[model samples]
Target: MKKLILLLLTAILALGCTACAARPYTPAGEPTGNAALDEQVLALLQELCDPKADLVTNLGAVYDFLCTGITYRATLADTSGGFTDELTDSLALELLQKRKGNCDAQAALTAVLLRRMGCEAQIVQGTFLRADDPEPVDHAWVYAVVNGTDCWFDPLYGGHFAENPRDYFMADDSRMALTHQWDAAAD
Candidate 1:
């Protein structure tokens, strides 16, 4: 009886340690607080990639879905007096319903989706210059750490602007800096 009790305690301790080790890092971004909307987003993610897929594969699926599945709209939501300066729950839901939005919406959706998918992600607000435009314009993109690799995903640039769409996925800081300007220390 004494030996059996010791074995059970050891097993329990091992399981507890495994759980702690497997816990993912605390990710950024806040939830919409709407259960239904959150479910819709998760459902969309499920539709995009298999639940059992690897992190990188899942991230790729999300990028592809955002770029191709949703149309780009060049308008930013007016959030001056609303819940926050950044993307709100209502705005994110509207993006889903309308299937179009500016860079903010794309980046927000990417961040939220990544957070739900068990990856560390954050929405990055910055400025970008188009080759045809002389002035830099406000833009938003996503930075995510996937499978121990720091990567950047730009849905708008990748889908709409880049000559090669794949260039924006998993991009390094130097490559992204060519067109995008942001505070390196902030992120």
Candidate 2:
């Protein structure tokens, strides 16, 4: 009887540790100082993400919103400038407002949302080769450190009209190298 009790206690301890490790996500990073922008992001999170789900599931929800909710367009704003802070901020806001953007805008918006969700994420400007295209084209995607593992999220290519968009979510370097080409040392 005492041995059975000890085993039960050990199992309870393990479960408790796991639950503690999966603490809820809190908003991180310096606020944009624009209340509207911050509010918009939070609203989107409320609509799209399940607060009780696992981290990867929540990330997938955001990716799904980007892939299906947002439309892809090479807007003048995307070509007019580089990824300056103002440009990135405007692009992210535009993506939420207009739901239209190119790869740059998609990546910028993804990074913004992920950062707001307290995930360490960044935009990666690189090249991508489609199976039908003759040459690789300039592209932008997201690189995130998720749960201490380096993961890649490409909404532009993986989400837009993809048969399996989830494949792009939380992908590692090896899996992303199938089409994405970027300087690993840069980010």
Candidate 3:
């Protein structure tokens, strides 16, 4: 009985030590401000300058520009406090100014910029499953009509339909089951 008790205590101590030794997962990569990117976007928009510019083109340009300029940082905690579904335009602008926010912040900022540019854009609430994730995680992205087709954009992913081409977003109607649609009309 003494030997059995010793063995059990030893096992428990070993397990606890192992758990304590384990390190929390940290995502790699540093945040790149990409100043050149801002210049490029400004130039693009300037070229498309018109009293009434095309909505699709303007929105697409802004989305692509933002995605290229910003780097994904997973350090942001889930700050969706009291936000039932989406953030308001003012909140989105505040996040943009801060330059450090979660996926929802990126989506909100993109939507607001696109809207200001005279493009109809909206925030898409859904689940994004990483290749390793067996189940999807709650996520948010932006979608806007470009050239008569709905184009989905994710700044967190940081790609312009190329380089970081997303298999999920590429689908014609691919959307997560938990997707909640928020729009100006609903407000």
Candidate 4:
């Protein structure tokens, strides 16, 4: 728990800048930004970013919204012979339109929303451990600052269809280590 707190603090402090430091939302095949897509993102951001709410609460709302709102499209690999790669920008845009994507799309959307909401955030690629599963699995999620504390969130968990969704929110890195690890090969 202490280690988790430390990691959270480190991440929050590192990304303390108010403006999200990220590339513009120009993904793979898309050349120009779509107004509808921009509105879609802004609409969601407005709903999630409440000035009256504390940053952590607002961020939690964002996490919950994406998890519950987006549909999970599973595949065997990151590429899936399409635009599902964890690091693809195009996947994010596609997710905004399709409303269904695998971990890559979900994570990309989560990171984009966090940045738009004024949190410095990024998507992370990693391996995950499930209790019933025999081995680790590749996955993607988001890391961002919440209420000045660094936090990790798995937006895919939103649609994980589990009873305890909060179990996946604002996790300390150590706790996450039980089920999550950064994929070195993804780099």
Candidate 5:
């Protein structure tokens, strides 16, 4: 009985240690605060408000607000590691603070702000065909159900919509294919 008790205690301790180690890190280089953060962001958005703030107009306003407010910089290997799979609002702030982020950060910030304004928004991972490239480049963007039609907005590309954003909504098709990996589905 004593041996069994000891084994159970050991297992519990091991599990506890694992859970502690697995805690997510707040993204580096961003200010993280509960009240202050919300206030700051809300104030910024309010400044750009239109009296007719419907989903389409509000989302466009927010997208333009972020794109214009935050300057874009390239991702650093050591800091952001080129891309962050966990693209939360805090992570977006971190990237914004550094003035650098990949497509993921841009999409994340856009998605979060849209959601706050009661828009149905989602982050989409996919490839984009740049002007010089025959092949599509790996990219992330926000898809919003705007006016009963799905529209894709790429904040990384100055908040432009893709040619056919609804193409991703085909049967058995997924937005995950646009990402380099399938793990973005978890976000």
Candidate 6:
């Protein structure tokens, strides 16, 4: 309990020190609120990854699991105000138990699961240009680095973005910049 809190606090402090609102470190896979829920998420993540698989293979499998498993349902019914900010507060367990959440929840859960599987993952928060709107709206997604390559994953958007889900899977930075305006995550 203490270690989880400390890790969370450290993550917060690290983000605080950054010039912009970077991804706050929320160590997942640790039992913070509900142990049962934690185990369930862990088990599901484990089920997704095959030990015999390579790193990219494991990441691809996990990314596919999250995109297919969760739906883009906001925790709050009122989305007129753009619920991304509020929904970001829910921890990974809550997102899993509920089985639906905004981009923030999906990305956070993805990052945690990837980290548990030994992939370097972090949540990236910023604005996303929704086609319906002229301006970018607050959004979050996962950024995982493997073999010196940065791969972007947005399980929320991954749901309906393309007939070929891999279109959004491990997207390169140049492609993501087209619609995503990342808020500087670090100093």
Best by lDDT: 2
What local distance difference test score does each model get?
A: 0.75, 0.81, 0.52, 0.67, 0.54, 0.68
RMSD of each: 8.4, 8.6, 20.3, 15.8, 17.5, 15.8
Q: Per-residue lDDT for 165 in model 2?
A: 88
Q: Tell me the tens digit of each residue's lDDT in model 6 across 1-187.
A: 9999999999999877885644323323344244565576567766776655677787788778777878777754333343242343345667778778777678767766766656677778777787778977877777887666878888667666655677677898887787778855530
Q: lDDT tens string, model 5, 65-96?
A: 55556566654333233334343656566654
TM-score for each predicted model, relative to the true structure: 0.75, 0.80, 0.50, 0.67, 0.55, 0.68
Measure candidate 2: CA RMSD: 8.6
* lDDT over C-alpha atoms for residue 124 of model 5: 64
Cα RMSD for predicted model 6? 15.8
Q: List model 3 lDDT by residue over 1-187, tens digit each.
A: 9999999999999999997773522212121233443333334445533324455444445555565555555534354552332334434544555555667767766665554454455677666555555776676776765445666666665452234434324224444222323342532
Tens-digit per-residue lDDT, 1-187, candidate 4: 9999999998897787544554332211222254555567776656565655666677788778877877667633355343332334566677878788888778777777666666766678777877688797877787777657777888685358345777678877675666678853642
- Please list the residue runs of candidate 3 whose C-alpha ends up more than 4 Å from where it truly belongs after superposition: 1-57, 73-86, 158-162, 165-171, 174-187
Q: Which candidate is the best by TM-score?
A: 2
* Structure candidate 2, residue pairs in collision: none
Better of 1 and 2 by TM-score: 2
Give the lDDT of residue 31 in candidate 3: 15
**TM-score result, candidate 6:** 0.68
lDDT of 1 at 38: 82
Q: Residue by residue across 49-164, what tens digits does model 2's lDDT show?
A: 76678777888888988888887788667543457767777888888888998998898888888888778888888898877887988888899998888899998888763578
Instruction: Specify the poorest-scoring 10-residue window by lDDT in model 2.
Output: 22-31
